[model samples]
Target: MKVAVIGCGLIGKRRSQTAMEHPLSELAIVVDINPAAAEAVAAQYGCESATDWKAAIAHPDIDIVAVATHNGLLAEIAIAALQAGKHVLIEKPMGRNLAEALKMAEAAKAANRILKIGFNHRYHPALAKAYDLFQAGAIGEIINIRARYGHGGRPGYENEWRGNPELAGGGELTDQGVHIADLIHWFAGLPTEAFAYLQTAIWPIQPLEDNGFGLFRFGDGAIASFHTSWTQWKNLFSFEIYGQKGSLTIEGLGKSYGIERLTIAYRKPEGGVPDLEDLVFDLPDTSWELEWQDFIEAIAAKTPYWGAPEEGVSAMRMLDALYRSAKAGAPIHV
Candidate 1:
């Protein structure tokens, strides 16, 4: 498939790396408002570059679009590509809020195109193992989950657009909590009620929360809780699931999610009590190669899709619910 990437930012460069190295794919075009960054990445990847994304979206040969731009623009680009009959892999948060996300999903549905959100953590071997164990009944019925993602607020944060709500969408909650919300939906399924507490603390964020705490009410009477911040000294993204017979913990960043060991404490259902198992894994295949390959295969097969646009919309709903609850100091129904 001929792939085009929009935005040559940090993640855009990383996402382009996979396409550059993939034998089955061609990096045909790259776009960014900053022509220099776009041109540099395009040259390094042996592709053409453009500052005019609208023109590139209309390119006749482009089969896939990777919307790796800022959160606000991803939905717009994806909608445009779907209208062009191109499949898209959009970055998370789907949109700044639910309304735009719903619009993007509607566009994908209308166009009959594959729309997958880039929640690559699903490919993490730690999470894969957890799913396997859960399916095998090793964990029994899952009862609770606790997760947190933290980092020293991005450099230049005080003066950066990331701290600006209009551009960055939100503070740590929207910036990073979207990942947690995606995980909650991915692992625990949708929830019923969600309440959150968000505060800026010392961060220079304006009209956005730098620190957040949330509680999710699952359908089965189980509850999940999460806390996250960008004010920490180091980056930390990790979660643990509590089940009747065992608990599982997965931790790390992009591509590193599966590199760490999967720690499990579970009872074997025999006479003995639960024990701990540490399973080390190689790094995750998060280079967009696996995701790209999968999307291409799915498009070719013309079968029922995976990670459809609706899933992205559902995730956005949860995020909006959490933020609204944070603002109201009460639980909000999904």
Candidate 2:
């Protein structure tokens, strides 16, 4: 498979590496608005470079396109690529808002091409194991989920593109909150209702909240409470799922977040001490590679992609409701 990665930033570089390393794939081109950035990555991957995303998407040699641009451009680029008959792997928060996301989904369906959203957190080893355990009834029927993900901003972060509402859509919620929201939906299905509170306490970014806290209630009475922030002094990622019979806690995400680990505890039937098991992974991050491979295999087999456009739409819907609820100060139905 020949791949064109549009946007030569960190995520694009990771996508390029995965494409180059995959036995069935080759990095054909790297495209970025900044020619120098595109050229640098192209040279490193031994591929062509283009400043125009249009040229990359229209290239006949490109079989797949990875859209790693900012949240605002994701829909336009992904829709264009799908319309051009190329499978697409778009970054998270699929679009700036629900309308754009819905349009992307419509385009994918109309084009009959595979469209996947990059929710790489799902592929993390610890999270993957937790999912398996959940499916295996290790925790029985899930009752609720609690997740918190955050990072401390560096100096001058307020001047970055992410601080601009036009480019980033929202603040930490649209950034890291989307990941946690997607995971919530993935594990317990879409929420029936959502309530949220957004705050712009620390960062001087205009009209964008640096902190977002939300509660989502699922149809089966399963609730998920999530918090995403840019004010965390220490980067952290923690998710806990409680089931009728037990619970699972996923902590850390390797590197600065500490060693990735998943702990499972079963409730004692006799009201004694519960049993506990801890699983640790000290390996390198392979989420980007695994997610890319899933997209590739889905295209090859003509199967439904795991993180398909519909899933993106669902996540965006939840986000939209959360934002609305925050504005209205009331719970909004999904």
Candidate 3:
């Protein structure tokens, strides 16, 4: 499929690089506000380049439009692509708020096209195994979840769309928080209610909070504590689950090229090999490639994609509740 990648920033370039490796995908064009940036990427990929995305969108050969633009503009770009008879793969935080995400979802429905939100966490081999174990009864019943995602104010993120509320969304919560919120729901089912506390303890220039913590209540006796922070001195990304039969952990499943290592510890039936063990994952070579591969296959299959608009809106709703809690100093019901 001929694809037009909007945005020449880090995410856009990374997506293009991954898409180029797929045999069925061709980099039809690249769009960027900066002509130089657009030209550079297009030249490298041997594709057309343009300053205005509309030109690329209008191109007849462009079958799919993968948008990695400013987060706040995702809905606008997605609606346009769906209307133009093109499939869309959008980077996360589908919208700044739920209203926009719903509107975009409505447009996709009217257009009758494949609209997918890029939630790559689910593609991590370690997390994927955890989900498999949870579903397979390796863990009896998930009672609680603890997850943390943070980076040491990573390089290149110092001044970019991630730090700007107008371009990225809220603070660390909306940027990184939305992903964990989405994951918790995906793993433990939908949330009943959520309350959060966000702080601006780091990144002085940005108006959004750099650290955010939340409590999610999902069903009876199932609660999740999650936090997303950009103030960590050393990058850390880990998740642990508590269940009746077993306890599972997927550590180091974060960052751009996350190392997926899954360790499962379960009670010995009576006498087994040792008390517990940590099983190493040895499946895919790269998670990014696998994710885009699935996206392409879903487009061809014309079936349901991994991250739907409803999921995005659901995450936004929870995020909204958390922000409200931060402001009110009290838990907000979703």
The candidate that wins on lDDT is 2
Estimate, for each residue in 106-136, the C-alpha lDDT of model 1 and write its tens digit.
Answer: 9988998888887776666677677788778
Query: What TM-scores do the predictions have?
Result: 0.93, 0.98, 0.92
Which 10 consecutive positions of candidate 3 have the poorest summed lDDT?
Answer: 251-260
lDDT of 2: 0.92
* lDDT of candidates 1 onward, in order: 0.81, 0.92, 0.82
Clashing pairs in 2: none
Candidate 3 yields a Cα-based lDDT of 0.82
Residue-level lDDT of model 3, residues 63-150, one tens digit each, is 9999988897788888888899998988888788777788888988898888888888888878877888888998788889998988
43-72: candidate 2 lDDT, tens digit per residue: 898999999999889989899999998887
Q: Report the Cα lDDT for residue 93, model 1.
A: 69
- The Cα error of candidate 1 at residue 255, in Å, is 8.6
Collision pairs in model 1: none
- Maximum-TM-score candidate: 2
